[model samples]
Target: MLYTPAPLHIPDGFLSILVSVVCWAITIIVIGFAISKTNKALGEKQIPLMGVMAAFIFAAQMINFPVAGGTSGHLLGGALAAIVLGPWAGMLVMTAVIAVQALLFQDGGLLVMGANILNMGLVTAAIGYGLYRSVAGQSKTVKLTVVGIAAWLSVMAGALLTSLQLWLSGTSQLEIVIPAMLGVHALIGLGEALITVFALAFIIQTRPDLIGEGSESAKASRNWVFAGGIVSLLVVLLSPLASADPDGLERVAKDLGFLSVGQDAPYQVIPDYTVPFLGETALSTILAGVVGILVVGVIIVLIARGMKAKS
Candidate 1:
């Protein structure tokens, strides 16, 4: 193994059903908030983009980075979305992906949806976005170096919070979990930073028209082609990184004795969600990411066409 995996892949038992329910309720409220970010809110044009963003994150999530000791983790994508879409909309997109993974793919735990959202959705979309904006506000385009650094920092921060959540839930000792989770992720965060910078750069170059404020917001759709092309490339490049070791969460749980506590989710993916090959973590993640991006791109196009139809 290369590292310990801490990505949210198991079902919940570390916490109670009540916790999951509360998180789900919170997810719903956040989604509602996200929907309100659109120019027309729930208009037909926005629905497609919303759905597409969900799929994009879903796909992006499949590619996990090898952290310490060969342990692997997935991409959270909140930062990317928040950079492109606003935080509220980013939350909506991220929640959709997590929800689908839990219900359809059976990836994340049902009980820890709140934990999942907090770690991936809220942390990345809200906190990460806040930092990015603070450094390079919505009006400014950060140098790729600056964006990469920010992305890495944002990912590191999110991983730290995930560990904290585990500690708070009594799943693992905070002391041990904190270092184990943060240490590995700090490295993985670089991968995130590189990918994020690349993606943002491509988008800006191809669709400079689609990125920013009023006129920019109106033109953002024009850059969909460039964005879609980037998606295709990411899908192809993503499958090679899955590590063989259990992730940070699993390692901490096993070491800290919380592994025995979380309800065992039936392992569905062969080699489950960590292998990088065609059968293991890598192949599935790449496939999932490509599928997700296409799904989102198609949805966005449909929405655009629909809005034009309505107009």
Candidate 2:
């Protein structure tokens, strides 16, 4: 039987309606600002770059690597996105990825999506870019070091925010939840850092112009776009090999006795990343992942192009 991956994000009923609403309000405001900022600065090449980044991030999130104590972790990709696309565009890319996960794959809950987007997308991008901008003219070694730190901190920030939301929702006490969430995520964050560092290192070595302020004037290259598409497809093809272990949040929730609080999605599209007709086979997962990347990539590209046109 195909392994059913545990929910990688906050599911429905994890937060009270009031907290969820508040998060929604905050997220909408931040996303509005991001759109305005990106509209003013988005370059022609960056439009397709946004799509490629979103596709890669979406594909990367599908494969969960094992961590200590039977828990697993996946790339959040905010740092990498921000480092490559700038924070505003990075936020947009992350928003597209997370939205697709919830709406298409039911990987995250609809009710808590605002918090998810805020924690995993907006905040991460901000932290990543904020820290990274300090080392703009540094060497590759220094840049990678900062990126790794930023990536790890981004994961910690997401965990901390999630813990707070859960506490505010009365799901757990602040003291207990904070430590539990932070402790496991600390290890998970290492994986995030390493993956981000390696990816950035590759980009820096091969296509240095694709990152930094220089990217604005970097001419669009079909070769880069095609290579990125192939990489995303390859990641999807490897989805079947992902570790069958509970993710950091799921592990923490189960340990804290709030695992039962997670509510099922009201509907299913390709629920749990498996094609319904295929009945939970590895091929089903690969196909579903392919569909997911394609949809998210197209959505982000369209949104970016629209913003570019407006600008």
In candidate 2, what are the lDDT values of residues 181-282, reduced to their tens digit?
Answer: 767777878989988998889988899776755443323322222323332333223222222222533544443333333322224212443322333453
Candidate 2: 10-residue stretch with minimal lDDT? 237-246
Best by lDDT: 2
lDDT of 1 by residue, 138-230 (tens): 333545665666567656556665654555455666556666766677777777777787778898889977666332343443343233233
What do the candidate models score in CA lDDT, each in turn? Answer: 0.58, 0.68
Regions of candidate 2 where Cα sits further than 4 Å from its true position: 1-8, 43-48, 63-73, 214-311
Q: Highest TM-score: give the candidate number.
A: 2
Q: Cα RMSD (Å) per model?
A: 17.7, 17.8
The stretch of ten residues in a row with the least summed lDDT in candidate 1 is 235-244
